[model samples]
Target chain A: AQTVTQSQPEMSVQEAETVTLSCTYDTSENNYYLFWYKQPPSRQMILVIRQEAYKQQNATENRFSVNFQKAAKSFSLKISDSQLGDTAMYFCAFNVGSSNTGKLIFGQGTTLQVKP
Target chain B: GAGVSQSPSNKVTEKGKDVELRCDPISGHTALYWYRQSLGQGLEFLIYFQGNSAPDKSGLPSDRFSAERTGGSVSTLTIQRTQQEDSAVYLCASSLRGLYSYNEQFFGPGTRLTVL
Candidate 1:
């Protein structure tokens, strides 16, 4: 069994500033995929970025990036130049590569507020 | 549509009533997944379907929750004798293949189910 944890319940960042949301996971498998998803007030879940466990380099998607530490079992999402539109709930997810099935285990989530 | 599509944007049903939610995966996608999201919460994996394979029902909360995919394309999640606890948003997603496929999943708008 695998599980994802988001320690931060709520986070706030000034517009144009940077914010980091922490995430950790428990998994027995050596290979897996990590993902960050965003949910806005409209209730649509959107993929922010994704990181492959085998890749030592972090994944970056425009303003969204991830610091993936395989040994520490940590995958944190960093949002740079945060804007009001970035205010939403962020979730960390994990999927075991061995399964060959796209079932993701998600964290409780972190609520981000971008202040103007 | 280019992305996953889900029907019945909103559904309100009395307790004990049955509710059905539908999901249409993107064409050529070999994997589809169902997840539940409570208000202000994270996604809970419910069931996963792969082309012509037995679906993974492990994430389903209870026997009352069931889902099936027809022709490996469109899927339906059925809740029998719905309980108030089932009140939440049901989401659908699809990827090119399973966990190891390296394809990113696209999410649907989701069906908001209110079991009153």
Candidate 2:
């Protein structure tokens, strides 16, 4: 069985500053995918960024990026130039090895507050 | 393009009553998944449907929970004799294909279920 852990339960960042949300997982598979999803007050789940385990380079999507360390089993999300709109609950998730059904296992989540 | 949509956005039912939540996946998506989100918790995988294959009910918490996808489009999750513990937001996501295909999923706004 695989599991994801988000050690930080709450985080706050000043507007225009940067913030990093930590995530770790346990899996023996060599190839997999990591994802960060955001849920706002409106309760909509939005895809933030994704990283492929095989790729040594980190994944960046505009202001959202991920530092994916395969060996350490760590995949952290970094938000640059944070804005008030970035205040939400962020989740780290991924599919287990070779599961064709696309079921995702998610972390406990980090409540990020981007202060103005 | 329309994303995944769920119906009965906010449903409140007394405990012991039956409730049915609906999810309409994006057109052309072959894979759909259902997840539960409790207060201050991560998303919990509940069920998944892929094309005509047998649905994955492994993540379902109990026998009282059941779900079905009709004609590979709309899905319905039903809770019979619901308990207060069943109160949570039910979310639906859809992807171009199954997990093995490595397609990113789009999520719905989710239906908030309140079992009073």
Candidate 3:
């Protein structure tokens, strides 16, 4: 079974600064997918970024990026130029690659607060 | 559908009562999943349904937790004799099928269940 772990239960960043949330997972499979999801007070879960285990290069979105170290089983999310809107609960998830069982296993989640 | 949708955005039920939560997957999406999120916690996989294949219920915590997807579009998760521990946000997600596609799971606004 795959298990994702987010060490930090809460994180805070000053407005316009950067914040990095740490996540690690334990999985026996060599190939898999890692994802970051954000849930605001509205309670809507939205995909933030994703990384494929096979890809050596990290994945970057508009303001979100990931530092994926496959060997270390670490997939961390970095938010640059953080704004108040970035305040939310973020979760890390894991899934096996191209398997018939595509269920996602998620970490406990980290609540991020962007303070002005 | 425009996106995955879950019905009864909030549910409050007494212990030992039965509760049913509904989900409507995005149109054309063949993969649907259910997840549970306890307060201030990460998500836990509950179940997954793909096309007409047998649904995966491995993540279900107990036999009291059962889900069914009808016509491969709408799903209902029922918790019989709900317990206080069953209080959590129920989330639903869907993704496009096919081995070549990126396994991006789009999530819905979850149903918050509060068992008293």
Candidate 4:
């Protein structure tokens, strides 16, 4: 079984600043994918960034980046130059690469508040 | 191109009534998934469909929960005798391919179901 955990239930950041949301997972599979998703109050889930366990380099998408430590089983999301629009519930997810089902296991989520 | 779309963005139903939620995936997507998000919780995988393969119902919580995808483009999740515990946002996602492809799953604005 795989499980994802977001230790921070809530986090706040000032506009133009940066915020980091922590995530950790437990999986015995060596080949897998990690993802960060954002869900706003409107209840729309949007993909933020993704990382492959086989790749040593982390993934970065514009202002959003991830620090993926495969050995430590850690995959943290960093939002740089945060804006009010960045305020939302962020989730960390894991998917086994070999599984044909393509189902995702998600973390508890971190509610982010980007203050103006 | 339009992203995934779900109908009846918000649904309020009686505790004992049955509710049906719908999802329309992207035109060329070959994989679709259903997930549940309860208050202050992460998204829980419910079921998955890929092309014409057998749907994975392993994540379904109970027998009351069931889903079906028709014509490989649209899906319907039916909840029988809904309970308060079933009150949550149901999310749908679709991807270009499944399994080792590592395709990103695009999500739709979830249907928020409230059982009273």
| Alpha carbon lDDT of each predicted model | 0.90, 0.92, 0.90, 0.94
Error of 3 at A115 (Å): 0.6
Give me the runs in candidate 3 sitting further than 4 Å from their true place.
Answer: B98-101
Clashing pairs in 2: none
Writing each residue's lDDT as its tens digit, candidate 1 over B1-116 gives 57888999999999999999999999998889999999877899898898898888888999999998988889999999999999999999998887454578789999999989
Give per-residue CA lDDT, model 2, range A1-116, as digits (tens): 79999999999999999999999999988878889999999889998998878889999999989989899999999999999999999999987547678778899999999888
Error of 1 at A21 (Å): 0.5
lDDT of 3 by residue, B1-99 (tens): 488899999999999999999999889989899999998788888998889998888889999999999998999999999999999999998988724
Ranking by DockQ: 4, 2, 1, 3
* Native contacts kept, each candidate: 0.69, 0.69, 0.52, 0.71
Tens digits of per-residue lDDT for model 1, A1-116: 68999999999999999999999999999888899999897777888998889999999999888888888999999999999999999999988888757688899999999999
What tens digits encode model 4's per-residue C-alpha lDDT throughout B1-116? 99999988999999999999999999999899999999989999999999999998998999999999999999999999999999999999999987654799999999999999
RMSD in order of candidates: 1.3, 1.0, 1.4, 0.9
Interface RMSD to the true structure, each candidate: 1.6, 1.5, 2.2, 1.2
Provide the clashing-pair count of each candidate structure.
2, 0, 1, 0
Task: Give the per-residue lDDT digits (tens) of candidate 4, residues A1-116.
Answer: 68999999999999999999999999999999999999898888888999999999989999999999999999999999999999999999999998997788999999999999
After superposition, which runs of candidate 1 have C-alpha atoms over 4 Å from their true positions? B99-101
Model 2 has fnat of: 0.69
Better of 3 and 4 by DockQ: 4
CAPRI level of candidate 2: medium
Assess the local accuracy of residue A109 in candidate 2 as a C-alpha lDDT between 0 and 100.
96
What would the TM-score be for candidate 4 when compared with the true structure? 0.98
Q: Worst 10-residue stretch by lDDT in candidate 1 chain A?
A: A94-103
